[model samples]
Target: MGVRLNGRTAIVTGASRGLGRAIALALAAQGAAVAVAARTERVWNDKLPGTIGDTVADIEAAGGRAVAIRADLTDRDDLPRLVEQARAAFGPVTLLVNNAAFTAPGRPPRPGATRAAAGPPTTAAPRADWPPFVGTPVHAFRRHFEIAVFAAYELMQLVVPDMIDAGGGAIVNISSVASRIPGAGPYRDFSGGVLPGYGGSKAALEHLTESAAYELQRRNIAVNALSPSQAMLTPGLSYYRTDFDDVGSEEDFAEAVVRLALVDPQTVTGRTIGHRQVLDGSFDPFGP
Candidate 1:
């Protein structure tokens, strides 16, 4: 089951790894020329695997068209250059995936540090001594919102003109279920690392998605927010020893995004979709 994306040009931010990388490869596999953008071009951090170069290499090796662009999403000024670089390599970007996120602040807890310890614990926990809202620094919240919300908005603005000129296009904002369900719920029921800053940013992104989709519909462009129904065992989550049994596949997100990208703007705009809905064939982006 493959979607046809021939003759389309796409720009996928955070394509160096995780969900972004998976989406980039899926788009390219369907014949879209992809611009894989991320901060890491090489394996500078041994702990973190994947890079823009690595993504491009895999795409090219698999006979898909792609190019690597090193761009930091945190720096607002660098966004236009990212789109420009992508356009230079693959023409105007009609498919934009805002997938990069600032993750420095909301990491899982450490190992065995007691409540009396000066610092925080080593593992994930919702304990009083853990780094929750009270323990989290203000700067961390600001940084996360800036990257996850501001950056995604700016990137969408950069690509709209091109998409309009091209007669139509799609923008997929990769959000998380946390945006809707915050605090200790089914997904957040884990031990530690339950910060609302990241989830708040994603919530903002989803709102932006709906707003953009409504305004852009007149121009034949479709903008939507999509999230995995469950947590994914990406490198980051895996670091905390997150069990994959209860999580969904990264490909679930990738496939749903590709499907959304191919849909007509009139039928599927101004909505936040989920991977489970997409898989079950009940994905109604226009539904209330």
Candidate 2:
């Protein structure tokens, strides 16, 4: 029981694969009753090891408790349903991982700019055309924001009351290292689709964490943004094909989250922590 979460309940979004999948399994392994949610029917199959279904099986097999649900975390309708589902399957959800995100599709900020023709260029990966923010499409930006930041806000808004009703809860927002380095833009290869909404939304998500933490502190709810890792070696990062040598394995990130979930609520609210610090124990993952 070093950091076990026995009898506690956790809901992890984006649990179909990648980081979301890892978070769910790790929590289950720690004795928390977990609900793995994502839009994959495969979660029901029990064949794959890291799938939502497999996480549930792993939890039960280890004498822990868990369940898997197929839901698109980005869809607006899915939030309340997800919360209710957890309440029904386990009890009040005391832990939440706001992990799903979408990149808005638009022409990247870098492309065909003359020596003196551009203002600000895109700074990060998939370094397409580094156009100024003014040049980026409004709609594409909105789409990314909806999925990355807005959806997360919605989930938090819905879940907090329940956590209050249940006495307390912990909220972890799975953010990227990009947030820490404001200059990096989207991945160039993956930017072909678009992520205006994604980047813009995450920028907003930082504020949401602040607001959520400030207002809910009185209620004993903890809100924190965890910069899990760079895109060094994660499957989630491979989806973008962006390279950053500092990225850690999903297990590395998961371990930090588990430690945070078990800590006291007051110590961890509103921190923007990176895997470097969170995993290396520079900062107490559970402390505010």
Candidate 3:
């Protein structure tokens, strides 16, 4: 059955660009009033395109309802305000898509970082990449967990009350395939390069999903984690790796999210399934 979210309100973080933006648009297209949250308010160059305003504009232009919310998810104080702004703009928030992640080491790519050149402006900033565990610092792990794990947990705590009061809701935590630990043997360098911090934080997030799902199921709140079956050609990914092929599309990923968002808590809660798994009906939530 197609999803219909005429009266639902949604909060989608990292909606400035890439998969998050696509997810926000998809949800809004389905009739949900979306609060598009992200740190980027304007695009400085082609390297990082689109902004929260751009996302909202696209939704509105398509005859959907959405609001642009500039929020730094790294700030604990911003969490409450984000939820409050969404609640004030629409009614209670019944859909929460925690799609933001700390991919780089420092603050997100800043606007105006590009300088005018003879042909076109280019960002002088060096691309950020995951280093070997021995080379990574302690702060890297902390930052990853802070955004990908703690922030999502905090948001869940903030929204569960509303879901409980409104009778039901859904929380979809975007995760990564890196969360899977390799089986004991000669481990192939298949994941490109797995950063301990990013992978570990996602592992924690999946655990959090299961725990929250178990606790909130009785209250009719579905909490699940989703990961791309393969790497997708997001702007962020392009900025880091240039050789990715056969990657999943943002539209397909967004559709999988919508399905999870509309799932019945009693049946599909706590699944850490892949995008293809969700779409193909091969996700066995109860299986190992």
Task: Give the TM-score ranking, best first.
Answer: 3, 1, 2
For each candidate in turn, the TM-score is: 0.85, 0.75, 0.90
- Candidate 3 local Cα displacement, residue 200, angstroms: 1.2
Misplaced by over 4 Å in model 3 are: 1-3, 44-46, 108-122, 125-129, 181-191
Which stretches in model 1 have alpha-carbon errors above 4 Å?
A: 1-3, 104-131, 183-193
lDDT (Cα, tens digit) per residue for candidate 1, span 176-242: 8767654545573554455577788999999999899989999999988888888887765554445
Local accuracy of candidate 3 as per-residue lDDT tens digits, 179-266: 8755356876776576678788999999999999999999999999999998887776666666766778899999999889899988
Ranking by lDDT: 3, 1, 2
- Model 1 TM-score (2 dp): 0.85
lDDT of 3 at 45: 57
Q: Each model's number of backbone clashes? A: 9, 32, 0
Candidate 3 contains a number of clashing pairs equal to 0
The sequence of per-residue lDDT tens digits that candidate 2 reaches over residues 73-141 is 556777788888888999888888887665312211123434233322233233334334676677655
Error of 3 at 123 (Å): 2.0
Winning model by lDDT? 3
